[model samples]
Target: MNILIVFNHPYEGSFCNSLLNSVQNGLKMASHSIDLIHLDKEEFNPVMSAQDLKAFRDRKPVDSQVISYQQRLEKADHLIFIFPIWWELMPALMKGFIDRVIFPGLAYDYANKSNTRMKPLLKRIKGVTVITTMNTPGFIYRWFFGNAIQRALIRGTFWKLGYKNRKWISYNRVKMVNQSKREEWLVKLEKQFSKF
Candidate 1:
């Protein structure tokens, strides 16, 4: 399997970065090819320019970066997103990456709009996994936002884009994570990626 790992953590020394390392090693041991993209290191502009937006919606050509990432997305068989939750949602950079990379014609087509049937562009991808952590508790998140990050990453986007067998592995209240719990989560993630 060709796996594309998208990382959004700003710090190279963070827990999310450590998680990425574990995921990469696990996937490699499972004989899967890995392509890692650290968003902060890349020159990705979150702001969609006026002319670019107009051209994109008008069926005209946009920047080459968008086209390039779209190609990566098309070729990926398994997609892994690594990020941390801020205010119960994805970071602005990751959200903006989705907006720019998952374009209209590339990710889906609006021409076939109807009441029922919707088109899916990423149907080729077999699995989508999200590895995220947060400072808040799971109970607090459930009571307030009801798994907003999971819904947005797994259901709202990937599922709609046709990535099957979606999975979410999140550790909440990271500020209180003990060494034992962290080790346990690392082992759990390794197991998950082995099956991927």
Candidate 2:
């Protein structure tokens, strides 16, 4: 299986980075080809500019970087996103990637030129898996904050685009956890993806 991993974190020593490593190792063990998009290393521009907005309005991407991402998306049979939750939501880079690359004519389009209807263009993708790490407790983020990440990533994006088989794995209160606990989570994550 061809997999595209979109990852981002400012610190190399962060738990999110370690989780990314575990995921890659497991995928390698399964003999799946991997293409990684490390947003921080690439210095991805998160702000959408006027030209970008124009291209978006035209239903075509003119930005070179977004175009490159679209090319990678075309080859991915499965999509995996690994990032940390900041401010109770996905970081700016991940959100920008979606705003720029996963636009109309790339991820979806108007169905029969209807304003309210959409047709997904990513037929090659079978499923989406998101792995997120955060300091906030799970219950608070879910019950109190209303799970903004899932609502945005799943319901607002992929699910609405007509893609099914969505899965989300979140590690909450990671900073407060002990080293042993973190290591156990990594081991479990690796074993899970080894069968993917």
Candidate 3:
């Protein structure tokens, strides 16, 4: 399987980087080829300009990098997103990648005559998995904050785009977790994805 991992984090010392490594190691154990898109390292432009918006309306990608990302996605069988939730949402770069690359006529299209429904065009994709780390407690985030990350990424994005097989693994209160606990989580992640 070709797993496309879209990772968003500027700090190399962050735990998210460790999570990325853990997931990659698991995928390697499973003999799945990995394609990583480090958004910050690539210096991806998050803000959509006027021209970009115009191109978006036309269902066309104007940015060279976005086009390349689309090509990479086209070859992927499974998609993985690794990021840290900030302000109850993903970083702007990952959001922008979705806004630019996962556009109409490429990743999806209107399925009905009324244009009220969408059909996913990424038929090669079997599923999507999102891994996130956050400072807020999981219970609070889910009950109080309404799991905004899942709402935006899983339900709001992929499900609405007609990709039904979606999963999310969120590590909440990451800063409070002890080193041993974090290592355990990493081990579990590696074991889990090794079968993926």
Model 2 spans with C-alpha error above 4 angstroms = none
TM-score of each: 0.90, 0.97, 0.98
Candidate 2 clash pair list: none
What TM-score quantifies how close candidate 3 is to the native fold? 0.98
Could you give candidate 3's per-residue lDDT for residues 1-196 as a string of tens digits? Answer: 9999999999999999999999999999999999999999999998889988898889888889988998999999999999999999999998988888897888999988898899989899999999999999999999999989878889999999877789999998999989999999999999999988
Poorest 10 consecutive residues by lDDT, candidate 3: 97-106
Clashes of 1: 0
Error of 2 at 26 (Å): 0.4
- State the lDDT of candidate 1 residue by residue for 1-196, as single tens digits: 8898889988988889879988988898899998887888986777778877886687554877767777788888888999999988999889988877777667766435562433667656778888898999998897888889767878888767666688888888887989888888888888777776
Model 1 residue pairs with clashes: none
Model 3 ranges off by over 4 Å: none
The local distance difference test score of each candidate is 0.81, 0.92, 0.93
